[model samples]
Structure formats: structure tokens, C-alpha cells
Target chain A: MIDFSNPLHLLAYGVMAAGLAFDLVGCIGLVRLPDVYNRLQAGTKCVTLGTCLLLLGVLLRFGFGSMGWKALLCLWFIAMTSPTAAHAIARAAHRAGYALWKGSVGDRYAEDDEGRNIQPAAAADRPKEA
Target chain B: MTALDVLMLGLALGVFLCLYRALRGPTPADRAVSVDILGVLMVGFCAVMTVATGKDLYMIVGLAWASLAFVGSLALAKFLEGRSFDD
Candidate 1:
């Protein structure tokens, strides 16, 4: 139900719709994806982007005077922390020896467990150009 | 219900869905991931409340909740790693 009369309303609704779409997609991916690493990837990236967009819409609607600055703060806080938590979770999972999905292509983590460098196998295999 | 109400309903549904995943997830890491998502959902819920109620304080609640959730998730991940920094 879009109201074409007011541009602000239209913009707010559109942004909220996009955010909800991302949220739904991320949740579905979390449920459907195999393995811890894959779930983490889906949940972290999609939710962060979705929530940020959702808050941005709120900020725009409410204007920076009231809900606006608070929305900005929440968005920034989530952006800073979500990825760090995701990295921590993934690293912890790998450290705890959580099994990768059977269809996983390769394991740079397997090759370099402690150092946690996630380069492709070919990079390690190829000779230096020099 | 208005758009904000609808959004809140959807967020609540998402929370329940994630809770199921957290409960039924096989491994510790799986639960941890879902739980982290739950914290984000908490923030969403608070934000919606702020909008619907017109209380800027709810947004502040959401902010404080977000950071606390992050700390909790970090601790959970550490626990999953078996170091039990949570303890």
C-alpha cells in the first residue's frame, strides 16, 4: 500500500521494504544453509545490511532531531560490531574443529589453522612470478 | 494495524524463527550464530518500539542493548571455542 502523495512516506516505505526483504532472505539462508560457517556468513552480512537500512529509513522519517541521531548511533554500533562478532564466531568454530560442509571446495583454514590466513590453495601452490 | 505494527509483528516472527534454530541447531557454533542473530533481532524490536511509541529513550535502550549483546556474543563464541571466557 504505497501512498504517492507524500514523497517522504514513499521513501520510508520503500526503504523499510528493502530492509525486510534482506532480513527475510538472511533468516531463510540461516535456516537452509549447511554448516556453521555458512550460516554465520548469511546471518552476519544480511542482517547487518538490513538493520542498517531499516534504521536509516527511520532516521529519515523522524528527522535527526529525535529518533534520527539515535538511529544513526545504533546503525554505526551494529556495523562496527556485527562483523567482529562474526569473525570471532567463525574463528572459534574453526578452532573447535567444527566440520565444514561436505561440498566445501577447499580449506585454507585447514592449511593454516593457527595463523588463520584464508588464501586459496592455488595461491600457495603457484610459483612466484619473480 | 499500521505499517510499524506490521513491521514489529514481522520482527517478532523472525525472533521466534531464530529461536527455533537456536534450540534445534546441532552444534555449539550453530547455536552461537543463531543467538548472535537473536541479539540483532532484539535491537530491531527496540527500534520499532521507539518508533511506535515516540520515545527516544527506546532508541537509547536499543543502543545499550546492541553493545551488551555484542559482548555476550563474543563471550558465547569464546565459550564455543572451549576457553569459557564466559566463566
Candidate 2:
């Protein structure tokens, strides 16, 4: 029942195009970035933005319908969950003793997670200097 | 240019970039995230493609695909976290 020639269709498509552009840039950043933290930032933010745009497009194209409402709901769920998952993964990596890239300029978590300071592997293996 | 066509081209380029990252990522987590993101891009692509081609029925499939991506990401994140996070 939706009208293809409606002005909303044009607007929807335009939003979708913009979203895709942002998603492309995010992927480029993901490839270029040095480590997980940086990549997570890029991937989470860009995909969220891109998908939102796409969902808007679909909603408009379909008008008020089941698929349209479902698409919007999916978009909402993604927006809520993706970043939370990213943060959880990053936290686990830190807790598991995965070292960050040496070239990383700053680290707030370094101060917060003092347990990481224990030199379990290298210090344990080396003979005493005395 | 028609809006749908332009959006389709743009999304196609985006998907290509996501695939590039998925293939080239240095670590397992990085690759997983890239792949997850790619799945999202695919869902979007399908939706846009359906609209562009006047195939309205495919919209439901696209929604399913997008929802599956969330579950996929959650699983991968748990896998990446391994034992400690679960504890």
C-alpha cells in the first residue's frame, strides 16, 4: 500500500546512503587501526550509525507495517547491545593480561586494574640477580 | 540520480570495506568484530536491495538476518572473553 513515488522514499534513500558512507569509513578505520580498543571504537560507532540509517530507509519504504516496525525494533536492540558487548570484550581482554599496543599513547585502565602489574611470567622465569 | 540506486551503490562500497577489514584484521577479536559488522552491513544491503528491486517480501528475511547478527555478536564476544568473564 505504500507509494513508491512519495517524497518520503527519497528522504529514506538519502539517509540510507549516508549511513553506508559512514559504515565504509568505519571499516577503513578498523583495518588501519593498530589494536583492539581502537578498532572496537570504530566498528561499534560506525555500524550503529550505518544500521540506523538503513533501518530508517526500510521503515519509510514499507510505511506502517510489520516489517517496518520490526526493523525499527531491531535497530533499537542493536544500538543498545553492540556497544555494551564491545565494552565487555575489551574489559575481558584487559583482565586476561593481553597487553595493549606499546604505541598506545594513554591508558586509564592501567591505573584502575592494579592486578595487571604482577609480573607473573617473565619475573617468575628469570634467575635472581643476587 | 534516484535515491535508491545511489544508496545501493554506497552500501555496496561499505560492504566491500567491511569485507576488507574482516580479511585483514590482525587478531581473532578484531576479525570477529569485523565479521559481525559485515553481517550487519549485509542485512542493510538486503533491505536496500529489496526496496530497490521492488521485492517487498524480502524485507522480512532482512529483518531476521539483522536480528541474528546480535546473537552472533554476543556469542563471539563471550568466546573472546573466554573463561574469566564468564566467571
Candidate 3:
């Protein structure tokens, strides 16, 4: 049996627990959020952090073995990609005209039928499309 | 069961929760984000399984999966960006 008394084991266990909690909470947010933008934000930040922490725990547990090295590489890969993926998804969602939540305060991307931005000043002149 | 095994179990539960989100998400974009979360969860599972089983191959599998997930997400995003994209 593995020695749970070891400091490394304890640390890995604790980090993994924390990562799991974060991941669960992020999933909850994804399900309960009112809009795609909010979901994107939650998924990008929470999952990236949770997955990286989990990887850190793995590195600690595995030391300098191939598993550890691969974990390290995966961590870097995720840290770099998750946000970019989120941004791309969000931009595409916005361009696709996925409606914002009814409670949204403002829409900077709102455009008139003439392809003009619709701000407060242009509210009266806003075309029918926006 | 060892602590690592329990942790892996929890990670699996988390993966299921992400799947639920992916299923119930209202819009294509929302679903896309769910997919992102799922990919990350897969990586976490891979990490835990490698250590628990004392195997090294799971790590490489996790890395390759992550790379593919990234590319898939980008392609999905591009398609959404241009809904007219046919190919």
C-alpha cells in the first residue's frame, strides 16, 4: 500500500480536491448562467485553473518521470489554449447574433441595419434591424 | 481504495457534470464552451489515471487529446463566426 503519510501525497491529494471543487463549480455556472458570454467566461477561467492545478498535483505525485513531464506540457498547452479558444468562441457567438440576456446593461456590438453602431446618441436614428 | 483513486472518482463525476452542461446548453456557442470544459476534464482524468495505474502512456494520450480539442474548438468557432460556412 502507498504511504498516505508522506507530505507529497497529502499535498497532491489536497490540490486534487481543490481542483475538483473548482471544476464542479465551473460546470454549475455553465448550466445556470443566463447567457453564452457568461458561460464562456466561467468555462475559460475556472476550467483552465482547475485543470492546471490538477496537473500540478500530478507533477508533484509523479516527480520527474515521463508522466510528470507530460503533465507539465499539458499544463502549458491548456494555459495557452483555453483562453484563445474561449475568445474565438465568444467572438463567433456574438457575430452569430446570439441574443444577450434580457438583463444585459448594454450591447457595444449592437449595429443598425446600415451597419452603423447603435449607441445612446444614435438610438433615435437606429435602424429597424438592431 | 487509495486517496488517488478517490480523487480520480471525483474527477470522473466532474466530467459527467460537464457533459450535462454540454447537453443542456441553449445555443451553439454555449455548447461550444461546454465542449471546452469537457476537453479539460478529459486531460485531468488522463493525468490521474496515469499515476494511479503507474502507466506513462495516458499522459501522451491526454496531450494529443488536448491538441485536438484546441483545433476542434477553433474550427467550430470559425464556422460559427461565418454561419454560411458550408465545408
Candidate 4:
């Protein structure tokens, strides 16, 4: 049983509570968001941070023990990989022709692709200058 | 119930929500994203378990799960992109 009277345990509980809140919100977003991209943004960012905070709480509760060290390791791994996976999923979704929500404001990826695809064609169409 | 118990219950609810999304998602991408989020949620569950049980093994499990989940998400994304694994 956690000793709530201990300041460290209280702090850990507080942190864990916050993490749970974030995770809950993220899951709600995942369900309620209009599109895949929107869901990805909400789910990935919020849940990643939530899980990291949870791990941090574990580290706090356990101090410098093996559990604490491993919690820190998991924290770092999750922080590093979650965003990378999100980015990859987003790119793949775009490439798979998953359309954005109608309310989406911009598509920089499409614009960038247009620029890359058009520039070469425009240059090729230009008369030989040399 | 203790705070940890409440936290764990909340996580389980979150997992069920993710499961709902995964089941009802309109597209493969949506399902993939839900599953990815589910993986992250499981890590939090493991972290809580580690503290609750005073066991270090759960931390190792969480670490392994995180990495495996990451790789699985990436593979699913690649498959969605219609490319070979090498590409």
C-alpha cells in the first residue's frame, strides 16, 4: 500500500492522476475526432505524454531502484518512438489516399509534392538555354 | 478504492474506448491508429501495475511492449502505403 502521508507518494499519486486524465481525454479524442489524421494527432500526442508522465510517477514512487531506472528507460523509449510512429502513420495515410476532413485548413504535404513534381516538368519544358 | 485502483480502472475504460474505435473505424488507417493508441495505453497500464505490485518485471514488460508496438505501427503504415518492407 502506498503511504499517502509521504510527500513523495502524494506527488506520485498526483502525477499519476494527471496522466490518467490525459489518457482518458486522448481516448475520447480518438473516438470523437472526425478523421484519421485528426485522431492520430490527438491520440498520439496526448497518450504519449500521458504514458510518459505515468512512467515518471512510477520513477518517483520507486526512487532510484531497478523499477525506477526501468521506468525512466520506458519513458525515454516511448517519448522517442511515439512521435516517429505517428509521423509514419500520417505519411502512409496520405500516400494511401486517405482524404482529410472537409474542415481541414491546409495540406502542406500535397503542396510540397506538387512543387516537387511540377518543377522538374517545368524545367524540362523550357527551351535549351546552353 | 485507492487512487491506484481508480487510475487502473480509468485506463481500462480508455482501452475499451480504443477497442470501440478499432472495431468501428471507417478505414484501415483509423483502425491502425486506434491500435497504436491502444498499445500506448497498455504501457501506462503496465506502469501502474509496476507501482501497485511493487514488481520490477512490469517495467520490462512495458518497455518491450512499447518497442514492439512501435514496430507494429510502422509495419502497418508501410503496408497501408502499398510498398514492400524494404522500401
| Most lDDT-accurate candidate | 4
lDDT by residue for model 1 over A1-130, one digit each (tens)?
4457979867876787687767767888888898888999998899888888788777866788778998999999999999999999998787676777878776666566435565434345533334
Order the candidate numbers by DockQ, best to worst: 4, 3, 1, 2
RMSD of 2: 5.1
TM-score of the A-chain for all models: 0.82, 0.80, 0.81, 0.88
Tens digit of lDDT per residue, candidate 1, span B1-87? Answer: 778878877777777778888999998888999989988877877776776787898888889989998998999888877785636
Per-residue accuracy of model 4 over A1-130 as CA lDDT, tens digit each: 7796799998998999999999999999999999999999999999999999999999999898999999999999999999999999998888777877878776666656665663323223334323
Give the proportion of true interface contacts each model preserves, from 0 to 1: 0.58, 0.50, 0.83, 0.90
Cα lDDT tens digits for candidate 4, B1-87: 988889999999999999999999999999999999999999999999998899999999999999999999999999988899998
Q: Which predicted model would earn the best DockQ?
A: 4
Interface RMSD of 3: 1.3
Ranking of models by TM-score: 4, 1, 3, 2
lDDT of 3 by residue, A1-79 (tens): 3557898977876887788778777877777788999888886798789889888888988798878888899999999
> In order, what lDDT does every prediction score?
0.81, 0.70, 0.79, 0.90
Candidate 4, residue B47: the lDDT equals 97
- Estimate the TM-score of every prediction: 0.87, 0.78, 0.85, 0.93
lDDT of 2 by residue, A1-120 (tens): 235678897677667777778777777777778787788788778877887788777887777686677667767766776677667666655554455666765556654444666442
> What is the total number of backbone clashes in candidate 1?
0
Which structure is stronger by TM-score: 3 or 4?
4
